[model samples]
Target: MGSEKKSRLPAIVATAVAVPVAVVAGVLVFNAIAPKAEPVHEDLSPVAVEVPALSEEDAVVCLALTATAPESAGGLQARPVEGGAGAAESVMAYGDPAVVATCGVEPVAVEDTALVYKLNGVCWYSDEAGLEWTSLDRQVPVGVSVPETHEQPVDVLNDLSTAIADKVPAAAEAPTGCA
Candidate 1:
């Protein structure tokens, strides 16, 4: 009886080890044979951007905002800026046509009748042509320029709003039209 029990223990231990080994081997083989999706390669040339001189306070805010900005927005990856000094800290660009954003820019001038939108805890105002969208609720307004090629430009704004909300502080008062 003792001899029989010892024999059975070895079999049970072997089965346990063999099962896991087989599963790992199968997974590795399957992965090796699986089809892989092609990686997307985008032109990462540094984009040229112009920014007004920033106040010390505004520069601090811009630095914080850009540091926390996402690597990708609206399905497009962030790209470098062309300016030699301080531009990369204040500006970010994305996509082929380049959805460009400049931090610490002058706020959008909102007329009494203009439409103001609050999305993802950020308020926004868009230009008549919808090519430009600016944050109306942040301490320093963030301006994002969308190309005409993007059909739904506001969608791109929505993607960026969350980061803007998190990193940038709310304005002392909401924009005139935005409650």
Candidate 2:
């Protein structure tokens, strides 16, 4: 009886060790055979981003972007606020092409912004509907022409943003004519 009990103990030990080793080997084999997942990159298109509701007389894009890039608590006064602090302060200040993406608003399309090449650090004058020379610090060529009504919405915005980003570098190359 003692020898039989000892033999059973070894069997139990062997079973326990073999089960764990089999499980581990099976996991390794499965991992080797499974297809790897490709890294996912989010499509950062502005229109792709869900747009917040828009009410007339409200600068939704600017306000949204301001929220994302908030300044220090009291620095709120220093950081530009959209529609409230004014367009020039809000839009002209952002020189990055990523502004539209950050704001989650499609860039506005207008007739006059087409012909005129807007310089970097200048606003498109859209928040105020072109009524007041509301220029904001935005990315775009200093004199890059803003898009007209006929141009595609996404294309125009993308172009304008790209222009804004390009304008700064171009301006740097051109000698200062004013001063």
Candidate 3:
């Protein structure tokens, strides 16, 4: 019984050592035989970003832009003229004869004292309007589609630059983090 127990101890010891070694060898063999994962590649190609042209109807000028006037004879104030037609309430008037005369422009009289004038692509009238050259203008209507206002003329150009930036598509792709 003693010899049998001693032989069993050797067998158990051998099994413990061999089992760990076999496991390690099996792991090495598996790593060498198993297929490796493929590397991922990104397909980055240039794409054309097309943005359509914006029209006046697509954008609207703020009421402040159409009404505010810098210092001048014809355009001396930021005053809004409310309620004449549809969406006409945003218009403001700036009238200064002294500034107008200095700008080197003539006035076309609408009334005896009030003259209809065109300046800076805007139409307006000054009661005591005098001939002057200014960066601002008082432009009256040559025909239909014109309204008379007593303030300095202002024409707000509706630009869609901001809208274009938000609406335009990305024509190119940028790299992400170290994927």
Candidate 4:
């Protein structure tokens, strides 16, 4: 009885060890053969914009400008606008509010205190914070909101100027003393 019991103990120990080894080997083989899943990307939702109303003619011009706007700005792809208000305007946003462009904005009143920048044959008026830029030379005003994250806002303006110039007609003249 003792000898039989000793043989059974060795068999049980060997079976226990073999079972675990087999499970580990099976897992490794399955991992090697199974297809790898593609990495998941973060969902970038559209930015919410509040746009002002526009005149009929201005709305048409805005639509044209929006249609011609670039698909991407500063390496960020354009996304749809959400929560917009007003008539016949379009909003183009990129990268969770990194850059935003709105057409059909009311013409900015260029005050003596305003800072004006001229680039790519277009004139832009900036508010005190310089966060917003309104095109002063277009018949129908267009505004671009550039976040502080951008090192150079002028580069973004330059990139969009061609589209604005091509689609939106230029005013007879820009505001006085605006360069």
Best by lDDT: 1
lDDT of 1 by residue, 60-142 (tens): 88888888888888888888887767898889898887899999888777776779888888888887898988888899989
> Which lDDT tens digits does candidate 4 get at residues 45-94?
76778776777787778788777778776566667777656422567676
Q: If the candidates were sorted by their TM-score against the true structure, best first, what order would they fall in?
A: 1, 4, 2, 3
Better-scoring candidate (TM-score), 1 or 3: 1
Compare candidates 3 and 4 on TM-score and give the better one: 4
Which stretches in model 3 have alpha-carbon errors above 4 Å?
A: 44-179
> Cα miss at 109, model 3 (Å)?
53
lDDT of 1: 0.86
Give all TM-scores, in the order shown.
0.74, 0.31, 0.26, 0.66
Q: After superposition, how far is residue 146 of candidate 4 from its true place, in Å?
A: 1.6
Residues 124-168, candidate 3: write the lDDT tens digits.
343333222121121211111112432323331111112112222
Rank by lDDT, descending? Answer: 1, 4, 2, 3
- Between the candidate structures 1 and 4, which one is better when assessed by lDDT? 1
Worst 10-residue lDDT window for candidate 2 reads 72-81
